[model samples]
Target: MYVSVKGGEAAIDNAHRLLADRRRGDRSVPALTLDQIAEQLVLGVDRVMSEGSLYDRRLAALAIKQARGDLIEAIFLVRAYRTTLPRFGFAEPVDTGAMLVERRISACYKDLPGGQLLGPTFDYTHRLLDEALDGDPEVEPGETREGATEPVSRIADILGGEGLIEEEISGNDEPDDINQTPLEFPLSRAMRLQSLARGDEGFLLALGYSTQRGYARSHPFAGEIRIGEVEVEVFMPELGFAVPVGRVQLTECQMVNQFKGSAKVPPQFTRGYGLVFGQSERKAMAMALCDRALRAGELGEDIVAPAQDQEFVISHCDNVQATGFVEHLKLPHHVDFQAELGLVRTMRTQFEQAESAMENKEAAE
Candidate 1:
């Protein structure tokens, strides 16, 4: 039995109004500006952009404000807005090798080429909260060093030269776009990377942590993590060359994991790659771990954990989709509940009538 109940128009309107009022809060304090959100809440904006799969910092900040500092809601808003935008032709893949390096570090080698540079990171800081941040505090200017004349050599390349690491295969084949095509099983590495790049930070972090805790241990080492700005260029058909469009900050991680070779090949370190739209080192690192874990099959290792399952991770990694399916239960299901309630009552009544008839028969006998 299905029934539709109407007459909540006014209620819905008022509820929306109430929500707006709550979002505004007490009007005595000055309202937050988009610039303040974009500049001060940089990490939040970065997360929104990374998860939303959009790079516009300003738009991300606006979504953050509209969502009342709820990052997930902001991500949802940005993704919704992204669908309406016009698609210009895809840009040529940005070259990370030529990136203007800001922060470069390696855990495997302490004295690698281009030396470790720790640019604005919380790695060395104490976790204690400082009350001084509550008020405006003057910040000392950061020390500047002479810029490198040439691109820094990647650690993977150094290892590759000695045959200590697996070689990265390059192909001219056009990678499948997840946006255009529905995801199918046994996804290409390119498609998997696309899905993982936009996956929820917390979810990836958990999966990555699981790998570290021996659920699907890879004996991973952070070969290198570099954060910098890379120039984006689009090919001009009329001009016969690519022109620089803009530069976007990015974080890239290369994880080296142990691989025992089979009959055909010798043991060599395997590599997992992670890249994101902003200076999101944590997300990048986590993505790298999960990426390596998902390669269990290719590496001839057993897939004994959730992180090793491609379908499980790819299907559930999307926070927006997960939230939508979970939250939809809050919507009215009164008709279905009512049908269940009626069925239970009818069964109870029938049982009571049968009991009464049995009692009467016993008494007459």
Candidate 2:
């Protein structure tokens, strides 16, 4: 095999130009606008924002257009672009508790303090193609659903009061972000959650389902899942307070799990948590289960399987990293493979000769 030359850069450039030409279609045809993509393919934009680790729908749409609808590539574009942008400040974590919530429901409660609001969902709608969208018809959504004044408290609050489950966020202290720095060996709650948020939806879904299939089956009820905009504020030491820096759309899920009798802990309910960048309740729910399953060791439960091991799950979670490395094997590896093949042949020949000599010696004896 010929030793490869490093013409990858030139090839990549040409490929990029080809992609641009294809995405644009005929030069005579109009190019699709970011707004159009954002409006028409909103679910794509949502997935990009959700998995891309970005909160901006417009930016996700732009990335999707630029990547020619390759979602993973679009996610990479968003992540790369986001790094260069200067941080203005952090926003106050919108008290989703005090949120002007859009959707809120509980499997754990009959009725919650903050009434359930099924704001905007296609949950019950049959997934039939509306031929109406075929024609160039312009339409607008109607007025917002009038919501309740009160915000909902978690159903786990009932269990928490009765001391059935361990508490969640420690109100007194804030956790550091894994993105702010590289993670060391052991991880904190913030770091673990951060890794899972950026992981692939399908991967998380599989891991979560494995638990139900007895891989680490811990029964969990969807305690509450909500999707909406939350106000974020960064603490300003100068002002000695956190100010509103921005708003981010988010999906959050908190699961109430049945924790049966273990060695140290009694039979009680526990919690699994997930918070992501956009309104993806499915991802959030799956993430919460996986998160709890990964916490098996710390929770003093059985760490019998890969899914139960925190290091195994979190280390393999990031799709961008995983996909890139896995695909790299597709690149030219002739030199490496040839060397390994030569070593194998040499070893086989030596083994055959040695066995022949041993057999002949025995015959001579």
Candidate 3:
């Protein structure tokens, strides 16, 4: 007998309890503190912040712990928390020229006005196991006060020094947030970039790498890759101007691409831009590459490759949405199975009737 598989509600309750126990784990081990997760697993926190679009380190850490160190789950947790937040208003545009840069480098030039600063990066590290960090906990350094750091001028200032690259100019435009509404076509540059920044790290990485591998074949030089904290401001209409709301850690990339001498001008450089939450160089660079690829039609180039497909790039960027829908399949869906059963039964009946007719015809012969 099947036992009729009763008490689904009770079974679900028991499953939830089991999940809670599994998530909490052993009593012998120390409960994972938020600080431990934040300081020790900073990159994980950064990824959660980037994808989740929230900047709270402690909350991100808690999400990581609760998610069992699964980055996607951590991102989902932060995202879930983020939606509950009520916003007062929007911030004003931050000037990159005034950015207090921590790490700034220009691939296009060896020497720039501000000079290169390699603040902190894992690029040089040989990823080997270090038993020392596990043994000795070091004393904390004294906290340096904010704004003690100075602003850096960009490398683009050099090209603009000789009228080479186009200088950015503000126009009448405001972007719609992807989180607020579904992405729509005929999107302005700001909206497109916003989507790409919050998009999947792997998806952007693959799209960026595809260009270097001759898929899109656009020649690109990293005009600049900068990591810094930029001030976000609020335009207080009643107060008549913008005011500093807060500061956010950001990774911004500007790529200069080789443009053919068009009918209007001589051969020169054009730009592709990306800016993302937290310090995410790979995502920023990938966004820049994809940004350039999507500009093919606007820039008078062919739009045949995957990276060049704006619809494709913008459509598949968000990791939170993607991973959730995918992982949700692990939840109960017996209703779908019943539909599949009906389909199979109908097909089986048609096949058996056909087979029986063929067998009877042979017997008569």
Candidate 1 lDDT for residue 195: 97
**Candidate 1 collision pairs:** none
Pairwise TM-score winner, candidates 1 and 2: 1
Determine which window of 10 residues in candidate 2 has minimal summed lDDT: 142-151
In model 3, which residue pairs have backbone atoms overlapping below 3 Å? 92-233, 199-317, 200-317
lDDT of 3 by residue, 1-365 (tens): 22345567798899889977988899897788999888877777888898888888899988988888888888888889989999878777787777778778888888877777776778778899877788657858755435437887777777878878765656866667776777678666777888887788889899898988888858999999998888888898999989887888888899998886689867777788888777788888989999988888877888888988888888778888788788899766677777899999999999999999999999999
Question: Candidate 1 lDDT (Cα, whole model)?
Answer: 0.91
lDDT of each: 0.91, 0.81, 0.82
Candidate 3: segments with Cα more than 4 A from true spot: 1-6, 137-148, 352-365
- Rate residue 67 of model 3 by lDDT: 86
Q: Per-residue lDDT for 166-208 in model 2, tens only?
A: 7765665667777787877578777888888988888888889
The candidate maximizing TM-score is: 1
TM-score of each: 0.92, 0.86, 0.88
Residue 279 lDDT in candidate 3: 78
The candidate, 1 or 3, that scores higher on TM-score is 1
In model 2, the clashing pairs are 90-233, 90-234, 91-232, 91-233, 91-234, 92-232, 92-233
Choose the strongest candidate by lDDT. 1
